[model samples]
Target chain A: MCCESDQPSLTQAGHRRGQIQLLAALSAIVLVWCGLLPALGRTTVLRQRIAFLEARGVNPSAKFFTEQEAGWRNAAEVERQLQEHPQAFWALPWRHR
Target chain B: MSQQSRQVSDDSLAMIAAGLMLAVSLCCTALGSTGGGGAAEAAASAWQNPLSALLKLPKSWESNPFAEVSGWLPGVVGSQLLLGAALVVGMLICRVRTGEFLLPFLKVFLLSVLAYVLAEQKVVKYYGLEYALWALLIGLLISNTVGLSGRLRPAVRTELYMKTGLVLLGAEVLFGKLLALGLPGICVSWVVTPVVLIVTFWFGQRVLKIESAALNMVISADMSVCGVSAAIATAAACRAKKEELTAAVGISLAFTVLMMVVMPPLIQLMGLGPVVGGAWVGGTIDSTGAVGAAGAMLGAEAEKVAVTIKMIQNMLIGVVAFGVAVYWVTYVERTEGTRPDISEIWRRFPRFILGFLGASVLISLLYENLSDGAGFVKAVVDGGTKTMRSWCFCLAFVSIGLETDLRTLSRFLRGGKPLVLYVCGQALNLLLSLLMSLLMFEVVFPEAADVLRK
Candidate 1:
């Protein structure tokens, strides 16, 4: 009779353990999604900057520090652009600057 | 198989796989197809998909939408998943039980993915907050807050990730590039750096009386060599406690930020031209990112000089890692009575340094022999292996955070000796780098500076 009574409780415990495992997996997935927030925001900014550069007739691909019109000379200039429109500045490749 | 044997077997397999990947990449680079344009386009396109943009999914996903859709991406995330799966298979092959490892490995993957995304954020990127720092911070937050569950234990393989990353980093260190700055560049980076490293380490040991010699070495290397990367290499070689590595890294990063912002303006005020300023900033700054950012502030000439000097200094990573490994095996862990045999030293030596050296030499040979091989090397190694290396480093930092207790770090900070060591080392580094830069670039090798200016 004792063994018979323990069966239902044992099943319940097993079910609970499964639930915790599932919850842990779900928690991890959620954390991953939330972490993407910053990258998503940055990407959006990069896209806008590319579009702005295209409109300005500036070849974003030109050798960095070579062209006088579009080329950035120093970090101060880059910082100024970033301050004004961060997406554009960050969108430019490291070599392009 | 026993757990110890299983671990050894798994590590050996990882080493082989890493070697194979490097060999194949080098061959691909030699075939006149480094895939630079394609890779860059793929990288730029990666920012298009919201999920990938946020997650920084592998470049493989850009070519195959199915991979992204199925969530089986192949670059950084894929490589880590594959590594985990391979370990599981290795266990199965060895006839070991693997039931407990699955959930913990999954947890590690999730955390690493999250850390990668955080690192990709604009503000973080602007500030040069690397994935390593973010991974460590996030892991610390999770462990200290919710606490690491029992299931997470299997996944926190910090040392494994670090060793693997170091091996991959070896491929990126091309000795040929050291000649770009010529002899003057060598003097500033090679000559002064070791002098500062030895002197600072001695100061820490004799004067500061720092308790952990490993910690002192790590700080000295980080300050005198290449910042965070140097700290990681030296700490691994000397078998530093996780908390000690953390303390050293924290100090380095904090000062890196301050120096990056403050140094450029100070250089301007000191009436240093772009060439001199660039060389000084590049040689002295703790972090490479900071070096570039600081040099960029001065102008393009400064930026060029800065990168060249930093590249020369980066060549020292292999030398420093090997030297530390040898020092540790010979002096620190010496078995008092008997002469240390070759076999014993080989056993005690960090095998990853061999992998690092092998990768460096192979790539250097390619750069020497092949036409436009530098481009190929940059394309294949930078685009492929370097990305994976970043992930490995991020994962390692995450593991460090998960394994560390806040109290453990706080206890190490009690006397603040490590802090003093870093500050003194950096101060000496600054004074020496300035003197050396002026002597080499301005006084001795002004022609090299002029060439860089043009």
Candidate 2:
């Protein structure tokens, strides 16, 4: 039953076509890497935005918590600040004014 | 192909994967100590932002693509080889013919690698399209168009890969970090997130009348919680189809890119300040990276607030997964008028979550109590297990794509109800999250905000 011959004609056709499609997909990846990706990176908008963010010491593309070093640094700093100012939790909102 | 035979096969597969999970976790933990005291202290301090962690990030490819690829390619290949070996052993234990499976597994791994490399492209990463999506797309294109051979069917083991990856991910979800934000962070994440999740889920179930409850739940969790990770966790808990997870990830990530780009500007225009703006972005944005990106744009204070809140929220996956599992056992999967036994729930519960939770506990303890543990564990994770996890998930998505039929998957989304549910849920999340962030960071705990601005 596990043999390919046991598969119906339609199923067999799908397997054959899938092989070809897989090749096409691989080709597309190559095209994108070689062409589309570099082109997009060079675009004015993305380049400018990334430059601006980098200048500000922000990583605009950081997707996960671990990816952002500034984040953990800031977390430690926040903890320290809170420790020094325990009353901040109850500090009057108007005090900021 | 009898039910009994399938059950036995599943048990064998799980037992083997369990061994693999333990091996990976232990190795990741042990690898932390390899850096010696000086390196560990340096990394530990760096985690406190006092320097080199960024140098080791996966983005190192930008500076020296070949060198970076050569550096990581070996580790990824080695880990995947371990996974492959384990599966082969499992197959042998099950008395399945080894020859039939090997070639298919190789094909899938190679294809998944291709997809992973493609997703790593700077433009794709910038657009926030993760490797999972690319893997699924490539597989889907092949399966739906050319169609796959029946011979390749033996290797599409999505569940195994997901379970293993989840265990690895568990190591990353250190519970100790949850305290970093204190009460203000808690109010914003714990209070607003679940409210938004439950309400959104209820809206999907009751109002939208979504046909597939699993789809509704996954989309709800993905939008409300931390995007792909939440969706993956919930989907596994509820045993949602891979196609549903794929769709949920697609919808959430697409919107994540838009929101990540748009929110910082919008916040500046509104003059919400970094605390509120960071909180808003953290709570509302689906992806952690996007949240950080958005927060960084607001300024360092906002980035910290945004990320810390999001990281705290990330911890909720443990509770959420357990809750969903319990709910599913007690209510969703119960037969009409029959009380569920403890044994039934135990059997039905997703065991991978236990692995996830266990890994989290193990790492959290190590991070908190062990001397220089933070640096060591971070080393192991950043160096070893993290890359392995990326490989695991990429393979899982590829397998999912291979196994799913596009026509059937489209049927799940026919009514556009999922899209409506996501948009509406996100709308609620944005509104509620904004209010809570204001109340917590402004009115109730404005002092916390003041400290953050420093």
- Name the top TM-score candidate: 2
Q: For each candidate, give the interface RMSD after superposing the true interface residues on Cα.
A: 16.1, 5.6
Report the lDDT tens digits of candidate 2 across residue range B100-188: 77778888988887676666666666666777787888778767766666778777777767766777777788888776677777788
Cα RMSD of predicted structure 1: 11.3
Q: What is the number of residue pairs that collide in model 1?
A: 0
Candidate 1 lDDT for residue B71: 47
* Cα lDDT of model 1 by residue, B1-454, tens digit: 5543543554454455456556545554445443444455444221111122222342211112233444434344555654565556545664656788777877787788766665544444445566677788877766555556667877777766777677878887777656555566778899889999999999999999888888899999989998888888888777787878888888888888788779999999999989889989978987776676667668777876775677667778889989988988777778777678788787767666787888888778875675545455555554456655666677788988877778777877788888888888888888999998898767665655565665
lDDT of 1 at B448: 57
Estimate the TM-score of every prediction.
Answer: 0.75, 0.87
Clashing pairs in 1: none
How does residue B242 of candidate 2 score in lDDT? 78
Off by over 4 Å in 1: A1-97, B1-14, B27-77, B81-103, B336-339
Predicted structure 2, TM vs. truth: 0.87
Candidate 2 chain B has its poorest 10 consecutive residues by lDDT at B48-57
